[model samples]
Target: MPAISDAKILIIATDGFEQDELFGPRERLLAAGAQVVLASPGGDPIQGMVQDQKGDTITPDILLDAVDIEEYDALVIPGGVANPDTLRTIDAAIEIVRGFDDAGKPIAAICHGPWLLVEADIVEDRTVTSWPSVRTDLENAGAIVVDRSVVVDDNLITSRKPDDVPDFTDALIRLVEEAEVDA
Candidate 1:
């Protein structure tokens, strides 16, 4: 299995994804020597939002439908109000998340990203954290929600917001390293 130095990380996102939530982790992980793959519902460029408005754009590495989950060692979901809301409605996106969870792979989500987890029905009885506005939804989905920078429940790593990106990505990197050691 690939370790932190070369672990394949899959980031599932779309237009309107929180800018920092996606790039923060991706950049940090890449600098740490991991292979990060950005996949979206579409293969075109996806626009990112900072908070409530446009921020930047990123070209997806591949389309969700074309990706083989087995190639990735972990999954990351970036949150923006519209990003997860739109993804939750996509069957492929939900399945990708569930596949990683079922395989006991590290799945990290921040802010509204946890919405996908809820939609995948994998949060039941699991403790997690997310942007304040998303706490209720996670609770409704049976997650024990907390107000923290980062929360790790088994292989699931979650965080509250953009400010928590550093901690969030760090936890994910650590998880990747641990998984590598275990493997």
Candidate 2:
């Protein structure tokens, strides 16, 4: 299996992403020696949220429509009330999520991030977990929803909230490593 140091990870987010949900996993992934790239709708800075309050802002490394799914080893989706909600509405964003799944790459989504997966229509029969409010939507989309800090089913990794960032990041890293072995 290829080491995480050799992996390239792509994170897609937009305005109102959960601050920790985006940064925590990203920090850990970079520390593990992965090349982490962030993509936004227009390659602009996006605002983050801490609960109901606005948090920090980050500039994306590329435009969502400019991403080529084949270049990355895995995908990460950080959740906030508006992050995934806004992302789901973008056709390019939804197609990116679907492309990752279709390519059999690892996908890690937390909190409301799974809404993109749901929007991509790729959640059916997959086991996943997300913020409480999003569980019903996952179930409605045919996912087997569960309550947990982190849940991993095949190449998909999910977590309940920001508190689960550590476990969520670990699961994503492991899945990426395993994908290397498969490749």
Candidate 3:
């Protein structure tokens, strides 16, 4: 693992986020000593979905409208069918993605999470991977989408699905650590 002490990681999600996709990586990042902040479309608690069913709910630390991309070192998008679908429609969420991209900061999206990247128009010509269902969307956005446990291209990292969380989290941690070093 990398030393992420004092690192600030921002996670963007909304209702319908995959339970594991959000919590698994959140826990790992916290354990690695990174400060994790959850941001959502609204300020209320966001419900999570497990295998497409209702699961636990978590209160967000901030609202998408309030996040300043420069305040955090990295961004994480946890996916579920409903999560990204809702996120893509939110201008604040899309702007956040754009801000991260323009700043050259690390942005990690898992499963259907890459939908936000497509919405922000940042995946064009980037190599990425996401849930099987969203492969076409990614490709249509001009991204070279692949099927893999995790794909790290430049400062963007992506994964196929929940089963790939371990590898995805590892890649994210390393990316953050490397960014910290570069800074």
Candidate 4:
């Protein structure tokens, strides 16, 4: 298997992404030697939130339209009240989620991030976990919603909230490495 250093992970987020959800995984993944690329709708810097408060901001590495699924090993979607809500309505964002799923890449989404999965229509028959408010939507999408820090079903990895970032990131990294072995 290739080393984690060889993994190219893609993260898609925008203004109002839960601060820790995006940074925690991105920081840990980069520390583990993975290449973490951020994609935004306009390839500009985006804002982050800590609960209801504004947090830091990050610049995107590329525009949403420029993402190439073939170039990445996994996808990460960070959630906040506004991040996924806004992204779900964007065709490019939803298509990126669909593209990652269609490529059978590991998709790690936390909190409200799963809304994009619902929007992409790829949650049917899958098991997942998300913040309480998003549970009903997951169930409606045909996902077996569970209450846990982390849930892994096939190529999808999900977690409930910001507090679950460590477990979430661990699961994601393992999945990426495992896929490497399989490849």
TM-scores, in order shown? 0.97, 0.98, 0.97, 0.98
Query: What tens digits encode model 4's per-residue C-alpha lDDT throughout 15-53?
Result: 999999999999999998999999999866899999999
Put down candidate 3 lDDT per residue, 50-70, tens digits, no spaces.
Answer: 986899999999989999898
Could you give candidate 1's per-residue lDDT for residues 49-104 as a string of tens digits?
98988999999999999879899999999999999999999999999999999999
User: Candidate 4 at residue 169, lDDT?
Assistant: 95
CA-only RMSD, every prediction: 1.3, 0.8, 1.2, 0.7
Q: Which pairs of residues collide in candidate 1?
A: none
lDDT of each model, Cα atoms only?
Answer: 0.93, 0.94, 0.92, 0.95
Model 3, which residues run further than 4 Å from truth? none
